[model samples]
Target: MSPTTRVLNASTKALYRLCLLLPLLANHEASAEPLVIELHIPDAPPLTFVNDPRGHGIVGDVAVAAMTRAGYTVKIHVLPWARAQKHVSEEHDHLITPLSRIPTREDRFTWIASIMPMERAFFSLERRVSSFAQAKETYRKIGVGLGSAQEDILRSEGFSDEQIYPLAIGDNPAQMLLMGRIDAWFNGVPESRYIWPKVSKRKLLMSSVGSNADLYLACSKQCSPEMVEHLRDAVEALRADGTVKRVHDLYLPQ
Candidate 1:
């Protein structure tokens, strides 16, 4: 073969090899570029907590795992429940996890996935009440976290403004119940169970007031539908692979 022809053939072979590697290089770069997502979580323990040195709890772990599997990098911000909801609602591309799926909040944000079922109930000193109706008759003041789903549920149940006691941020209603400031405390079962032992040693009575509601990952309206579906599918994959249950078991009360 002529010298020029040999050189041209060698160059063509090298160019073909480079072309084969280009797609792989592009794919690696795309995979390395993780989609950064902002997550807002509440301090509700056993389900979610910020006190841990790692800044995560059960739901936090589950959320991080799911988002990671969905090809995104997660940035978790622990905030008060009200503030978390507000941030997710007002900010673009923000998400809040483990929020109750209620009618009042259905249209406020894009629902991503159902994380777990939450039981809404009223907690009082043992023997104080057997049922919600009895509790309403026995307790004049019902304590609830201010602007919480518990408060909204109570109102929907026909609780008057005079009968409802809204507790400030970081306030524990179980302590208020023990202190006799309120006759009954309203909150989710998981949160109430986690807080009861921390606040008081007294036995408490629990009466379910509302149906079990599924907690969800809610994103800002500005979030695209494709992103929401991606998260939903991620959660489903986690659940199917037992990742969700494994994470929940790690933080569950033993």
Candidate 2:
């Protein structure tokens, strides 16, 4: 070939190679920019909490592992349940987990994955009450955490607003029950069980009141669809590989 023709062909090849590399370089730069994810967790022990001196908990660990695997830089903030839910509802790209999937909240957020199954129950001081019907008829007051699914369930079960005693986050309802401040306590099985031993020696009369609810990791409605899909895939993979179960087991009472 002529020298001029050879030079032109070489230039064309180089230009094509550069064109191919440009998009890849751009993608690399985008990926290098960390995906900043915020998780709003409550102080629910053995499920999600900041320990006295450390920060790892069951749901927190699972979430961090899954998101890290999915290439996100995660930042978890421990806050009151009400505040957490508010942040997820109002803030863009915020996440909350170990949240019970209830009818009222179904449309508020994009549910990413089911993390655990939870049962809501009514508990009275040992031998104080037997059936839910009896408790309803006898007790004039019930203690439940404000802004919790348990509180909603109680309201649906015909408990009047006057009969409901709303406790703040981190307040021990079991203690309230023992103090006779409330006739019964309505809460999740695991959470109630975890707190009962610390507050009372009497065995609680437990009566299941709600159907099994699945806890989920959910994101704000304003979260990008791409981010939601990424998180969903990561959590699904963790469940499939037993990482979720493993993390739960790690925090179970020994």
Candidate 3:
């Protein structure tokens, strides 16, 4: 072969290799960048507290730890319970924390792992009922979180619209109960107990277990499987290492 032709052939081969190498380099750069994940939570106490400096709340603290362990940057959004749920449901790769895993929500999102167990009950200042049936007949206006799993549970159990006073997730239920706006407050037991003391020094009576569920760290239906697996593994590790319980204890009274 002529020297010029040989030089051109070598140059052509070098350029072709460079073309193949460029994409790999680009992919490496992309992979090296930390993935940013959105974490949404309600202003529910013991689960999340909007702007609590002490790591947000129990589930919030655990979520941050898990996300950090999964090698991702988490951006937390404190939204109303209903709005947060709707947005997470519509968006891709978004996460909602402390979401109760119920039959109605089984297909709405991808359940990553259980963050905590949810045992719901009714709390009253003056009224007490032995069973749901009795409570339904006894209480005229029961307070519940707006668009929460508790509301869904009540509706499913035949609670009429007029009977349920849906309040935004917060300490308002305790205040409402004290003000005589709601005859009873139906919510997660931990949340109720946590708020009752903050709002009033008075004691409240709790009814029998109203609903049972597991609160989960869930992603949107269109979430990335790789991300899901990373978070799932991180959360499982935290649970196994006693980190979850440790975080939970921080919010509960000693």
Highest TM-score among the candidates is held by which one?
Answer: 3
Q: For residues 130-207, write the lDDT of model 3, one tens digit per residue.
A: 778998999999999887998888888898999999988888888999999889999998988888988988889999
lDDT (CA) per prediction = 0.79, 0.79, 0.89
lDDT of 3: 0.89
List candidate 2 stretches off by more than 4 Å.
Answer: 1-27, 52-55, 126-132
**For model 1, the run of ten residues with the poorest summed lDDT:** 126-135
Measured by lDDT, the strongest candidate is 3
Task: Give per-model TM-scores.
Answer: 0.82, 0.83, 0.90
Q: Write the per-residue lDDT of candidate 1 for residues 170-220, one digit (tens) a residue.
A: 347877889998888888877788778778777888875555788888899
TM-score of 2: 0.83
TM-score between candidate 1 and the true structure: 0.82
In model 1, what are the clashing residue pairs, if there are any? none
| lDDT by residue for model 2 (66-86), tens | 788888898878777877787
